[model samples]
Target: MNIYAHFSSIIARHLAALVAAGELPAGLEGYGFTVEPPRDPSHGDLATNVAMVLAKPAGSNPRAIADKLAGLLRAEPDVTAVDVAGPGFINIRLRDDFIRARVPEILREGTDYGNSALGSGQKFNVEYVSANPTGPMHVGHCRGAVFGDALATLLVKAGYDVTREYYINDAGGQVDVLARSAFLRYREALGEDIGEIPQGFYPGDYLKDVGLALVAVFGRTIRAMDEAEWLPIVREFAIEAMMKMIRDDLLALGIKHDVFFSERSLHTDGRVQDALDALKAKGLIYTGVLEPPKGKTPEDWEPRPQTLFKATEFGDDVDRPVQKSDGSWTYFAGDMAYHYDKIQRGFSHMIDVFGADHGGYVKRMQAVVKALSGGEADLDVKIIQLVKLWKNGEPFKMSKRSGSFVTLRDVVDEVGKGVVRFIMLTRKNDAPLDFDFAKVTEQSRDNPVFYVQYAHARVMSVMRKAAEALPGVDLSDAALAGADLGRLIDGSEIALVKMLAYWPKLIESAAVAHEPHRVAFYLYDLASEFHGLWNKGNEDPSLRFLIDGDKDVTLARLALIRAVAVTVASGLAVLGVEPLDEMH
Candidate 1:
C-alpha cells in the first residue's frame, strides 16, 4: 500500500511499453525516476521526473516525451488526470476514491504500516554512548544515547540486523585514577580522616557508597595489602560499580546495548598483540619516528623514533604513533585492536558515535580501519555536539570537576524517560542543542513533544467519544475492513489521509540518511496537519468527526482519525516515546 510506489510502477510499465514500441530508446535507465508529492498540492497529487531524465538519452525533446507519457498515464484507471509542467515534469492527480480508500489499509496495518525492507538483511553495528567508565553519564551522553538507539530501531524496521554496542574505556589512565579515588573512599569507609581529595583524585561522594560496600565485603583484609596487589582489586571493583551506575542511567532513559565491549579485554586475551601482528603482516604496522605535532607542541616534547603505523599511506595527517618512547601501547593501539576484533566478528558495516571533542580523532581512526581491513570494512563516526543546558532562559550552572555535573539520572528524574528521549533527538546530532528544562515541560505548541503527544491523545479522545455516541458501530477490523471511505469527501479529510500515505516513504528516507531527527520533524508535521484539521471543524460543522444524521460519513471520518493515531503512535514508538492517550 505505498500509493506513490504503486503509481510509480504503473508509470514505469507504461514507459517500458513506449520503449518497446520504439517511441523511446531501448536500454534507457529509469531507476532514478521517482513519484513524490508535488511541492504545490494544486499542481497535482504526485509528480515524476522520468520524462525529463529520459529525454536526453532518448534523443527527443522533453516535452514530446512528457506528452507521450502523460497520455499513457491518463489511460490508467487509477490516474484521473496527467499534465506536463515545468520542462517535461509529469504531474499526476489520482482518482479521489483511490486516495480516500487507503485509510482502511492504514487502520488494518496499524503500527506496521510504514515498516520497510530497504536494508535487506545487511549487518550493521552501531556503537554509541561509549563514555569512559569513570563516572555516571551526563547530559552530553544523552543525545548520542537517544540518537543511536532510535537509529538502531529505524534500521531494524528497515530490515537491517543492527547490534547496539557500548565501548568501555576501563583500561586507561582514567580508570587507574578511578581506582585510586575508590581506594581513598575505601579508607574513608574504614574510618580514616581523609582530608579534601588530592589534586589528581576523584572527589565525588557517589563513591562513598562503593567504599561502604567494599568495607562490608572485605572488612580490613584489603587494608593490609601492598599497592601493587590492591590496585588491581580496587580497579575491578571501581569499574564494575561505575559500569553498573552507567547501565542504570541508560535504563532510566530507555536505552540498552546488545554488547558492552571492554578495552581491557583486548589486553587480557592477547587480542591486542594479535591485531597488531595481523596489521603488521599487511605492512600497515612499522617501527618509525612520528613527526612532532604541529602548532605548539609542548615545550617538553622531544622528537624520538618510536613504533608507528603507516597511517599516512591510508590518508592521515601523519603516521600515528602506536607505541610511545616508553615502550607502552598508546590509546590508538587498543582502538585498532577493537576495530579489528569487530571486523573479525564478521560485521561489515560499523558506526561509532563520539562526542564533538573527538572530531580530530575521526580521520585517524578511519585510516586505521581502512589500512587494517584493506578497505573491506567501512567505519562511520558520528560526533554529537555539546548540550547547552538552560532553565528559565538562563544557562544551568554545573561544573564537571566539582563532580556535581548533572547525570543522566538527574535528567530522567526531572522529566521522565519519554520527554528525555524525544527532546534529545529534536535536533541534529552534529549541531549544538539547547535543552531548556522549563520550556520542554511547558504544555504548548512550542514544546514539540507535548504537541505530538497531544495530537495522539486528541485522536484517542475522538475515538472514545464516537464509541460512546454510536454503540456497536464496529471499530473492529472485520466491520471496518470493508469501510465505505468514499463518504470522506471533505478537502481537509483528504489532506489528512494524504499525509498518512507519506509515512512509509518518510521512514525509509530517514533510515537511509541515518538521521533520526527527521522522524521527530515528520511527527511534528503530522501533528500540525491533525491539529489543523481539528481547528477546521470549528468553522465548518460538516467537517467535524461526529456528524449527526450521517452514520456512514461518521464511520469514514472515524476510520481516517484512527489511521492518523496509528501512524503517530508508530513513529513515537520508533523514537522510544510513549504515545499519550490523554494530555495532562
Candidate 2:
C-alpha cells in the first residue's frame, strides 16, 4: 500500500465533502494536491500543501483553511493529530499503532509486498541490445543489455505485458562482409593456405568455427561455386552462428529476449513496400534533395534528389533519406518498416535502448513512430553511454578486429554475472560508467552490490538465529503477521519501517519514469537503513532483534528484517541481480 497515495485520496475526498457542505469554496475541487512525507521527520509523518493551494482560489487565508482542514483530518482513522505548519502546509502525525500495523502487513505479503498495478496490463514493447549479427558481443554491449532487461522486468513488476526484443541488423553490408570473412575461414578449413585476412575483412577467429561447420556441411564442393552462388549461403550461416554467440553471451548475464526480429524480414513478403506505402499515402515520402550536412560536408558531396521521409514534419531535425541515389533502400528505411511493424502489432507503448553512438538517430526514429502511429502511440529511446573498464586505475580496451578487446564473457567470467549486472546499473544509462575489476568484488560498504547483497545475507543469518533463540514460537510469516508490532517503538526501528513503507511508492514512480536504475539506488538506500538498524543494536541491547525474555518485540523485529530481505530480493530480481544469502 502506498501511504502517500492513500492519504492523497483521503485529503481529496475530505475536501470534496467540505465543498458539498459549503464549509469550503466550491471551485477548488479539481486542484491537483500533494500529500507526501515531510522533509523534516520531526514535523510529522506526512505533509500536504492543500491549504496553500486552495487559499487564493477560495478567497481566504491559507492558515484559516488549514485550521478547518486540520480538525476534519484529525477525525480520520490512523491519523493521531493534524496541525497547520508554517505558511499553510498541513503536517499530520499518524498513530504509532498505525505505523506498527504495517510490519505484519509486509510480512504477510513477503516478496510481493511492492508489486504495483500502475501499467494495468498494457502491452509494452522494449527493444534493446540490437547489436549487429556480424560478430560476438563485446563488453561495449553490456550496459544496454542489462539496462533494457532490467527495465522490462520493472515493467512486469508494475503489471504490464512486457515483450523484450532484439533487432538484428542482418540485411546490411556488414553481414555481406561477414559472409566474405567466413569464406576466408571456409577455404582455410578445406586446407587452402589462406594467408593473413585482408584489411577490410573481419579478422576475428570466431568465424573459424563457422568455416569448419560449412566444410562439414558442404564439404570441398562449397569452394567450387562463384562468389554470387556462395555468398548467400555463407552469409546466412554466419548470421545464425553470430546470433547464437550473442544469445549465449546474453544468457551468461541472465538476459533473454522474447523476440529476435530480423531486419531482413522487413524486406521479404513486401513488408517494406507495405510500410513505405502507408507513409507515402500520407504524403510523408517524396523524392527530395537533402541540404548539405553542416560543418563536415564532404568535398564530394553534391545535390542529388533522393527518396526521403518527411521526418522534419514529425519533429526530426531534418528530412531523412529513405532511399539512396541508386534507389536502394537505406538503413533508416528498414528501421522505419520495423517500427511500423511494431505499431501494427498493437504495441501502444514502445521503448528502444540504444548505444550512445546511436544518439543522432533518436529524433528521426521517434518521428517514424509518431508518423506511422498517427500520434496514437508513444516511443521512448534510451541511449547508454560508454563503459570504461579499469584495472588498477589503468584503462582497458578491447577490439575484436584487433583481437584485443574484452568480450562480455570475459567480464562475466572474471567477476561473475551478478557483479557485472549490478555495476552496470549503478549509474544512469546516459552517464559514463567506470567499472573496476578489483572494486566490484571487494567486500566493503563502498561497493553497492556487495553492500546490498550483504544486507540480504545478514537477514538470512538473523532468521537462522531467530529459529534457535525462540524455538517454541512459530516465526512463519503467518504467525509474525499477527505479532504485537507496537512493541517496535524504538527510534531506529521506526525509521526502518518508514523506509520499508516507501517500497510500493518507489516502484510506482520508477516504473512511470521507465528507469530501473532507480530501483538499484532504492535497494541501496533500503539496505543502508537495514544496516544502520543492525549497527544500532550493538550500541543498545534493547534494540536487538532477539530479546531473551521479550518474544513479542523480537518477533516484530524479525518480521521487519524479513520484509527488508524480501523487498531487496524483489528489487534485485528486477535488475536481474541475484541477492546472496551468504556473502562467502
Cα RMSD, each candidate: 2.3, 2.3
- lDDT by residue (tens digit), candidate 2, 1-584: 77888898888888888889998878886787778789999988999998999988988899998898898899998998898989999999988777777778787787787888889999999999999987778887988999999999989988899999999999999999999999999999998999988988988888889899999999988699999999999999999999999999999999999999999989986678888899999999999898888885678579999999999998999999988999799889899999999999999899999998999999999999999999999999999999989987898654444254678888888889999999999998899999988789889988999999999999999889999887787878788788778788888888888888888878888888988899989999999989998888989888888889888888888888888888898888888987888989
lDDT of each: 0.87, 0.89
RMSD of 1: 2.3
In candidate 1, the residue pairs with backbone N, CA or C atoms under 3 Å apart (3 or more residues apart, or in different chains) clash, namely none
Error of 1 at 544 (Å): 0.7
Model 1 lDDT, full chain set: 0.87
- Candidate 2 structure, TM-score to reference: 0.95
Residue lDDT tens for model 1, 1-584: 87877877787888889988988888775446878999999998999998878887888899999999899888888889899998899999988888887787888888888888878899999999998887888888998999999989988887889999999998889999998899999999999999899998877778898899889888989999998998999999999998999999899888889999999999899888887898789887777766666675677567787888888887788888888888888999899999999989888888888898999889889998898788999888888998988999899865453285777777788788999899988999999999899989999999999999999999889889988999877776446657789888778888888888988888888887888888899999999999999999888888998898898888887788888888999999899999999988
What TM-score, over all chains together, does every model reach?
A: 0.94, 0.95
List runs of model 1 lying over 4 Å from the truth: 23-31, 51-68, 297-301, 313-315, 397-402
- Candidate achieving the largest lDDT: 2
Instruction: Name the weakest run of 10 consecutive residues (lDDT summed) in model 1.
Output: 397-406
The runs of at least 3 residues in candidate 2 whose Cα sits more than 4 Å from the true structure, single-residue gaps closed, are: 22-33, 49-68, 83-89, 297-300, 397-404
